[model samples]
Target chain A: MRLGKRRATPLPELNMTPMIDVVFQLLIFFMLVPHMTRVNKELLELPKLSGTEDQQESAITINITRDGQIIVTNEPRTVAGVVEMVSEEIRRLGGDRSRVKVLVRADHRGTSRMVNQVVSALAKLGVHQIRVGVEVPSR
Target chain B: MRLTSRGVQRDRKIELAMTSMIDMTFLLLIFFMTTGGFMTIERDLDSAIKERPSGRAASSDLEPAIVEITRVGSGYVYRVGSRELTTARELTDLLRKFPNKIDGAYVRVSDGAPFEMAAAAIQSCKDARFLSVAYVPID
Candidate 1:
C-alpha cells in the first residue's frame, strides 16, 4: 500500500460536463422554439389580464396588428384572406374541422371588428376551438 | 508546494473556478423556469357566435344578456342590453346580480371599438359565467 500513499489525491467532484451540455442544448432549444410562437415577429402588444392557460399544441396563431393588419405565420392577409387561410389550415389538418384550433393574438389597440372578423371567419369554417392570447397580469 | 505522505514534494491542488459557473447556470435556469417557456400558451377559448351552435343551446327560455360596447372617440361606452353603463366592473356586477335571469352573454362592440374594450367585455362576461356567449353584429 506504499504505492497508494505516494499517489496524488484525486478531486472528489461529480462530472458535470454532460449535465452542462444538456443545459446548453435546452437553452438553445427554448430560444429557437419561441420563434414558432411568433412572439418576436409580431410587434403587437397583446391584451393584458390575469388569465388561465390553455394546452393546445395544434393551434394556429393569427396575429392582428393595431392598424387592422392580419398576419399568419409572418405573411400578411386581409380579414377575408384570414378566412381562406384558416380554411386551408383546417383542410391541411385532414378536414376534421373540430381538430382545428385557432389562436388570435391581437394588439390591445386592435379594433373589436378585427377580433369579430376573426371569430366570424372561424365560425364560418365551423371551427370553434378558438383561443385569444393576452398578456400576463402584473402582480 | 506540499509534501506527500511518501516524504516527496508535490504541487498544490489546481483549483477550478466552477463555483461561479454553477451560480450562473442556476441563475439562467431560474430565469427560464419563471418565464414559463414550458407553458403551452396562456389562452382562453371564446366559443361565441358559432354558425352551428350546439343543440340544447337555446337561450330563449332563459333571458339573454346582450352587452354593447361602443367606441366614442378615444373612449368607449358599455351597455347591458340597452341599459348603459360606464365601466366593465359595473357590467360584471349587473350580470352577477342577476345570474339566474341571464343565460346568454353576447358581446357586441362597435366596428371601431378597441379590442381592449372588447376583451374587457369578454372578461366581465366570463366572470359572470353566462351559459352562452353570442357575438352580435355592430349596427
Candidate 2:
C-alpha cells in the first residue's frame, strides 16, 4: 500500500540542475559567436566568382564601400592610416611581414582604384600574402 | 501546532518553480540560434601584389599578358594587347587560346572601373590556366 501510494504521487522532480546548466552554456555560446564573427566583416556585396579559393584566417581586414571609402576594423581610414595600422600589426607579429595575411573586402560595385590603393599600400609594406574577399555562388 | 510547524518547514525547503525559468531559457536559446544562423558566409580569393622594381625595362621576350579594364558609358571594356573585348567570356576565350602563355597575366584596372569587372578579369585569367594573375591599378 505504501508502494502504491508512492507511485500515485507525481514523478520525482527531474534533476533540472544539469539541464539548466547545459542550456545556459548554450545560451552563452550563441551570444558570443555573433560578435566574434562580425568583428571584422562589414556588410557589403562581394564579387561572385566561380573558381574562388577558400578563406584563410587573416590578421587584418580592409573594407571598401561603393563610394570608395576605406574602412579597417569598422573605422574609416585613409591609405596612409591603413599603412600605419598595418605597420603596427607587423610589429605585433614580431616584425614578420610574411606571417601577416591581409584580407580586402571590397564592394562589387566599388571602384577598383580603391582596392588598388589598399593593395599597393600593402605591397609597399612587403606583405605579399593578400586575399581579396569574394562570395562563391551556392550550389 | 506541531503539524503546522512541519508544514512551514516544508514550505521553507525552497521548491523553485523551474518551468518558467526553463521556458524563458528555451526562448532565449531559440532567439539566439535563429539570429546567429542568419549571418552569411564569405570566402576569399587569393591575390598577390608585388612592388615593381623602379625603372625596370620590360623584356620583350618575357612580357606577361596584360588585360586592361576601362569603364565605358554604362558597361566596361577589356583590352588585351590590341584586342578589345566587351565581355569577360570573350576575354577568357581569347586568353585561353593564346599560343605563348609562358608568362602569367596582369589585370590592369583603370580608375572608375567596377571591382566586379576587375575580379572577373582575374578569374578569367585563372580560368585560362595562367600560372599567376597580377592586379595593377592604372590611373
Candidate 3:
C-alpha cells in the first residue's frame, strides 16, 4: 500500500451529554426547591410547629407588628376603625359567609393581647371563621 | 458527478443552536433557587367559641379551666385554674398534669403579657390537646 501525506487535524467535538445532564439537574433543583406562598406581609418570626401545615385563604388580613400595633392589611387601624371596617366587610360579603375569613398574622415577638382584642371585636361582630397565619418551617 | 454515500455523510454537520436557550434556562434556575425561602404558612383557629357569659360560671358542670398569663415587670406570672406558677419549669409541670380530655381552656392574657408568655400559654394549651382556647384580655 503506497502511503500518501494526510492532514492530521484534531476534531473540535464538544460532548453534549454532560451539558444536557447539568442543565436538567439545575432545572429539577429549582422546580422542587420552590414553595410558592401567596401571603406577603413582612418577615414576622412566626413560631415553628413540627408539621402543622394548614393552607386556607382569608377574606381580610390583619397584621400585628412586633410592637403589638394592629393594622388591617396595609392600613393602621384603631379599634373603632377596625370594628367599623369589619362590620362593613361582613355586610359586603352578605350571602357567602364562607368567603368572610379573617387572617391574623402576628410577629413571633408580638403580644397576644392585640390579637385578642381583634378576635374579640370580630366575635362581637359575629364573624368567627378566622385563620391564624403561622410560620411552619420544617422543625 | 454523483457523490458517494461516505462523502454525503461527512459533507454536512447539522446542529441546533442551544447557547441562548441554555443561558435563559440558567437565569430562570437562579431566580427560583434564590427565592425559595419566601414560604408562608396558614392555620385555622377553632371558630367562634362562645365565651362564658360574664355573670355565669363557664358551663356549670365542667367549670372551664383557665390559663392566666400576666406580665409583671420583666418577668411573667402564670395561673392554671387557681394554681399559680412563677416559672416555665412550673408551667411545664402543670401542663403535664392536664387530663387526656377536657371541655376547653380560657387563656386570660393581660396587655403587659409579652409574646413569650402568651406563646407559651397557647403552646401549653395546644400540647394538652384542649378542644378550644378562648383568649380574654384584661385591661
Candidate 4:
C-alpha cells in the first residue's frame, strides 16, 4: 500500500465588506456636519440673558467695527447717517418709534463712545426698546 | 491541458503586485489624514451662557443714558445727548448724580471715542458701583 499525504486545505477567507462600510460611514459624517463659518469680530460680547424669556425677533442688529465705524446692514455709515436711516426704517415699518427695538452689536475693542453715539442717536429717534447684544460671559 | 509551468510563474508575479496595491492604499490614507487638519475654527470668546428672562425683566426698564465721544483731529469730545462734555470730572459727576430710580442707568458709548475716554466712562460706572450697567452702541 502506497501512503499518500493528503494536501493541506488553504482557508480562503478575506472579508473586506465590513471595513469598507465603516470607512464610508465616517466619510458621510464629515460631509454632513455643518462647519462653523467665520463670525463677525465687530459685534460686542453680549452677556447671556440668563433666565430671560425669548425676545421677539423685531430688534434691529447694528454692528460697530473696530476703529469706531458704524455698520448698518453691513453698510458703513456715520452716526448721523445711521440715525437718519434708522428713523426712516422705523417710519416705513409703521410701528411706534418708542416700540421699535434697537440691538447694538459692537466689538469689545470698539470704544464706548462710539457705542454711546449710536445709542444716543437711537434715543433721539425715539426708539425705546434698546437691547445690548453680548456674548454670555463665562463664570 | 498539460502542467503549465509558465502560467504558474506569471501567477507568482501577480501575487507580488497585490503587495504593491496595498502600499498605494496606505499612501492615499496618509494623505487624507494629513489634509483633514485644515478644518479647525478659532474662537475669541469662551463658552456662552443662554439667557432666558422670565416675567417682567427689570433689565428692560433700565433707561440707557448715553455719552458720545468722537475722535476730533487729535482730541476727543464727550457728549451727552449731543451736548459735548468739557471735562471727564464733569462726566463722572453726572454719572454720580444719576437718581436711584427704578430703572437703572444704561451707558451707551460711541465707536468714534478714544479708548481712554471709554475706559473713563466704564470706570465711572465702576466707581458708582452700578451693577445694572449696560454698555451699548450709540449709532
Candidate achieving the largest TM-score? 2
- For the candidates in turn, chain A alone yields TM-scores of 0.68, 0.78, 0.63, 0.58
Candidate 1's residue-wise lDDT over B1-139, tens digit each? Answer: 3335632324444455576568767877886687665333345646456443223213333245667786556678886645667887888888786546345677776678778877777777777877656655463
Point out where model 1 deviates above 4 Å: A1-41, A52-55, A93-95, B1-14, B19-41, B50-62, B71-74
Report residue B17 deviation for candidate 1 (angstroms).
3.6
What lDDT tens digits, residue by residue, belong to model 3 across residues B30-136?
87677655545545444333333232223223255566786556777887655667865576566656564456666677666765565556556666667665656
Chain B, TM-score, each prediction? 0.61, 0.59, 0.65, 0.43
Q: In candidate 3, how many clashes are counted? A: 0
Question: Interface RMSD value for candidate 4, one decimal?
Answer: 10.9
Tell me how large the interface RMSD of candidate 2 is.
7.5
Q: Candidate 1 versus the native: TM-score? A: 0.72
Candidate 3 deviant stretches above 4 angstroms? A1-42, A50-53, A93-99, B1-3, B10-13, B40-42, B45-63, B82-93
| C-alpha lDDT of residue A109 in model 4 | 56
Go through the candidates in order and give each one's C-alpha lDDT: 0.67, 0.76, 0.62, 0.51
lDDT of 4 by residue, A1-139 (tens): 4356434444455555556556656664675454322232233433332212233343465677657777776567798887877787788779577656565655655555566666656656766455544443344
Proportion of the native interface contacts kept in model 4: 0.17
Candidate 1 has a DockQ of: 0.36
Positional deviation of residue A84's Cα in model 3 after best superposition, in angstroms = 2.3
Per-residue lDDT tens digits for candidate 1, residues A15-97, read 66667667776876887686567542475677776444553554567888998888877888887787887778777889998
* Residue B47 lDDT in candidate 4: 13
Report the lDDT tens digits of candidate 2 across residue range A8-126. Answer: 22334556666777777787788778677776788888888864577888888999999999888788889999999899999999999988888988999878878888888888898
Residues B1-139, model 2: lDDT tens digits = 1222344334444366678677767877787688665555677667566545222223342245778786557878987765778988998998887666656677887767889988889889888888777777666
- By TM-score, highest first, what's the ranking? 2, 1, 3, 4
